[model samples]
Target: MGSEKPSLLKGTVDAVKACPREIFNFWLFFCTAVWSFSGVAKGFDEGNIASIVVMKSFKTRFVLDHETDDQYANTKGWIVAMATAGAVFGCLACVNLVQRLGRKNTLLVFTLVYIAGIFGQTFSSGSLSGLYASRFIAGLGIGTTTVIPSIYLTEIAPRSIRGLITLQYACCQQLGVVFGFFFNYGITKHNAGTQLQWQLPTALQLIPAVIWGVGLLFTPESPRYLLSKNKRTEALKVLCDLRNLPEDHPYIQEEFAGIEWQLNAEIEAVSGASVWDLTKETFTVTENRRRFVLMFLCHMFGQWSGANAITQYSPTIFGYLGIAGEESRFLATGLYGIVKFVSVLIFSIFIIDFIGRRRSLITGICLQIVTLTYVGAYLGVTNKMSTADIEASSSATAASKASIVAIFLHAVAWSIGWFSIPYLVSAEVFPIRIRSLNVSILMAFHWAFYFGCSRAMPSLLAATHRFGAFAFFASICTCSLIYVFFALPETAGRSLESMDRLFERPWYTVRQVAYPTAADLADGGLGDVERKITDEDLNKVTEVRIESQTSKNH
Candidate 1:
């Protein structure tokens, strides 16, 4: 599998086409749905910060009025980015935590940390330092929450629906964002001047964390993690339950065989390897290093594509587009949130898997390029007008309305491609041996950029026109589209181990390895690949595996 194009289609066709019972089960969906709630925790935090900062009570309590423009920008930047900074540390720390505690426990533990951060944030009152520290502490939870769920989902989900399952985390994140927006809107309408207006949203972040923590208790630990711990019997049982099939079912056996094959290979690689040896290998090995570089670029590109800036600065951007007043801008921002949530939901359900990762990314990036460029060009013309003339001109207002529409379209486009795919690619692209280390490294970079980009928005917008920022984002999206179209492989339907082999190809040719022909699988990959599984076949496979182990051990 490390060097061969294994029959990815084999499992889907033989397992599902020949199986007695269905592969997709209620429990499998239920467990994944529960795990996906962790995304909500991260999203809730992301969605609320900008809105909360704009609230009158939040501003007054924090005493934000006295600062000069630059000072105000710096303070606001720190306030918004601190949670992400904490998340960076959390992401880095998760590699060891996930390995030691297993995915479910790691999530539960982090959820508690997240909940505690919420408490401190809600009650910190006027203390900015306390709020920043608390958000950082909460970010530690967020960093782990964001990465672990994708890893866990990748390990547990069926290959056919793995993309869909992983994307559900993204969907849940959008749901939480929607909650953040509407919660702020509802509070503004009902609780306007009270501390509760801000505190309610901050405290409300706890609901998702609490639900995820409680749900983790009932969910199964990742079967792959169990197997890694040498809990083979338990792992097999969990796999059976997850698949809703007999332990001896062909689908079960084939899936087990693929995973076992890779685990054995990893054990062999790490048998006498020291910490330095593994670390060196992670960098020195061509495949491992390639995966790392690819992951780093993907996350970096996603952040720089300008979606976070839009979400975090939506109200302000709306104002720049000439949407008048605090209430109107906030209302427009809430609608922006709804647009994002609905777009992601639609993309996840109908588009992601069907289009596959590369196509989805390309399509989305193209749309973003168009929308961003139009917005930038529109503002370039209109910014030259006098305030009275611009306000009085119907044509200026028409262009402004069009820019808002473009922003919403950009959200739709961003959701389709960059928003969800990077995490899924991170989850499925690496083998278990380096999966945690790799995902943690990449996610930390992501959060770091998230912090940098979101934090820099105030300065970026101030130093340049909003149009210039949009133009820069559009340029980045253009570069991103080129990178994705040529470099990123389609990872939608393949088994995880297959990804190792897929990347084993020369870096330039990696994109060509997504799907193998029937003849290719039979001749060089999984032999006799398309036949139904039988008892005799399983026994023969087991015999070969045993003999290989015996000879290697000797």
Candidate 2:
């Protein structure tokens, strides 16, 4: 194995070079990066609120009369969770809107809605009712923007680099988190208890929304959406533009043909199928059902992995560890955001495609399980210690430092596994016909669980303290590890059109599944290998195609 490592690395490098570099042209890069602003908006909302809640001014302005600590904690959780609650409705509403309005238009409309919500949030500091209403509206925008970008990026990206490109969403989200944290930290450190400290951060959310919305106007509509609507000429044109290739390029023709064929197959399958029938088939069809379960479970596991709890309540967690002082808490929170940002950035660039989806998720989850267990145990023991003893004992200080290290490590692990895979897998697994609807359904569950976890974190910490909450999350990670090991298939480097065959087999199958060639489908040879094809079959077809093309040139 050690001797073969260099050969394998060389082969991988050769394969990458064989692909066209034109795919990374300026226009494509611009569009892909701009689409990430939606994620930034989401990250900003999540991170900004967490920091704002810890602000003295925010609490002074918003906390109720004669509110106890528990009540205050609940109020903080609710305020932080309101955006997620709004996101649920937005996800559900976008199911049909995406199909009708198309990806670009849907994102544009919702971004405006998000900006509107931001204005409300900025100005409504005087009234809690207005604040809640504005957040829910913004949540609606977030839901729509979040789901559409994944779909759009998946459709636009070339299959070879799809995983890496799609990961832009996660990277941008972390970027937003970092910005939010530092923005809040700066305001808190300088502005102190002034309303502008919180208000300025709230207002800053508008920048990404406007940038994404305006950028959408310049970017073309999704070719997949165009094809789905039977705009063949427009789809072809957009494909050419996106690839920076001509209409007659063989690669372009092959890709277009593949998409058309897959769309036709789906149309044939769902010819007379009603909404109820489609939903029923989604669960009853073995392949569809399996994919749905995996995607849903992935989302659930990612959210329940304690990422949001740590992010949304980092200050509180620091406090629980006996790290007192507002400046210290904010500094810790800022460091947490920075670590997450850097970790996610590194994973997206290096590990995502290299390790494949299954291994990355399992490895990350296992690491999390160990970290959570250690943190939970340490916190539990410390909770039992008297304040005087804790202050004087060197062991307590050492344990506190260890807990901080554990939390940072947990962030790194979560970044590698749960942060982006759920979205990437969901975008790739579902058939194009039902992609929007299926993804929306799963996203709703994501937001719902996100809301639950965020809302419950404060109360959970109040009722169970540090140990109970961390242990509970650790148990969830354990279950996630088992499920991933037994169920989730590797999807890295697979074509979107080939996912149906990929999920049809049992989990134990180790051989690569071959997708049928264009000629095979045209000659009605698809009948022979409609179920599954092996790697050898694909190589044979490729060799024949190369030979025929060479012969024609001669």
Candidate 3:
């Protein structure tokens, strides 16, 4: 028999090919879908359901004007606002807690918040305070859900499919919102004033949470978290379960080693290494700082594109534009969800590598600017139309239709760019030592902006009206595109370490080369392959550098 050559690269490739695709993809999709269940409620839950149905029911059934007539006008915004606020607080508070609690525990806690929020929104009575409080609690859960899932998925996913899996979360979010808007539209259409109608919709939100919590209880916690706990054997077992591998699987060893090496490397970057060791590494290391900056900018740009405003208040924006039929608008929003979901799926399967991150971001942001600009112009012109102009013609009606088109396009553009890529990039760029902490900080900014944008957008649109708000988001998109065009690197086919190296150096090669070209790597390399390193050599470096740095810093 011919001797078999020891081939590290070939073995790695074989392991990936041998891994179970369905199991990995299922968790990614399921986690995404569970959190996205609330997306359906974003538009209607914000007093719209109360306005359209609940308040009127209270008036007719109980002869309560305060409950039925003016209740939503006075209180719905705050109710809607509370969830966003709760999410902000939840994410920030959980930043340190996420590190301690680990990914799976945090996710489970958030799922419980969903269950609590739904039951409260469904059965609670009298004051709106209970409903709002529940949503606020849910929002805390929602923020954590949003942040941690992306972190977990990014960590567990193979680099090749990580971007696609991350994008699934964004799709689920949009799909949930789309579904909620349309689902309520259907439920309230003929019945209109049924309290039972609102109850059913709010109650449905808990289904995914129940499923996710139940399903994940049986599933493994993140192998990365297992490793951090120094439970190597358990981590290996979790990896095997997650990847459908045997205990002696070669790739299992490689990935475990990769994470360990990365962690050990970060320990070397710190001094007086205590519990805050991760933070020390991030601040002191040149590469870690650069990765943080890149991830930070991604969040800043992603939020700046106005994704929250659109998803949170699409129906309100449609109403402002004078879209006549709530039913048709809701249908269109559902269609928008379908488009986003399909587009994300397509991108995940085919376009992610071909188009690359930098180009996709630029394209999505630029398209967003254009769509928002068009919407603004239409609204601006309609806002200027006089009472006579309004009565004499159907100009506002035409503008509303145009506005829907623009909004749909904006959602599509976001699916292509700002919605999913930032999370994927944030999770991918960081080393294993501080991946959770780093992602938490970036997601904190993300959800904070989400809270700010959604809460402020309604008031902004109500006050400045459509023209100003749309234009403002458009301007933000322009700036984001410019930033991507200049600063971001093309990490399409790069390895994790190579991605780290791209940011660590003073210059970005991908930015310099307008397209993927021969000059982009050392000796025209693709820069996607993993390098093999021995545990002995890795430990030697870890011992020497860490002790040196700690002694010097202390």
RMSD, one per candidate, in order = 5.6, 6.7, 7.0
Best-to-worst TM-score order? 2, 1, 3
- TM-score, cand. 1 vs. native: 0.83
Instruction: State, as a TM-score between 0 and 1, how close model 2 is to the true structure.
Output: 0.84
lDDT of 2: 0.79
Q: TM-score of each candidate?
A: 0.83, 0.84, 0.77
Candidate 2 per-residue lDDT over residues 46-101, each given as its tens digit: 78888887777877777564577788778878888999999999988888888899
lDDT of each: 0.79, 0.79, 0.63
Worst 10 residues of 3 by lDDT: 524-533
Which of the two, 2 or 3, has more TM-score? 2
lDDT tens digits by residue: candidate 3, 310-388: 6656655665566545565555555665776677667655655556677788888888988999988887888876545
lDDT of 3: 0.63
TM-score of 3: 0.77
Write the candidate numbers in order of decreasing lDDT: 2, 1, 3
Model 3 clash pairs are 39-176, 39-177, 40-176, 40-177, 40-180, 55-68
Best by TM-score: 2
Model 1, residue 317: distance off in Å is: 1.5
Q: How many clashes in each structure?
A: 0, 0, 6
lDDT of 3 at 103: 79
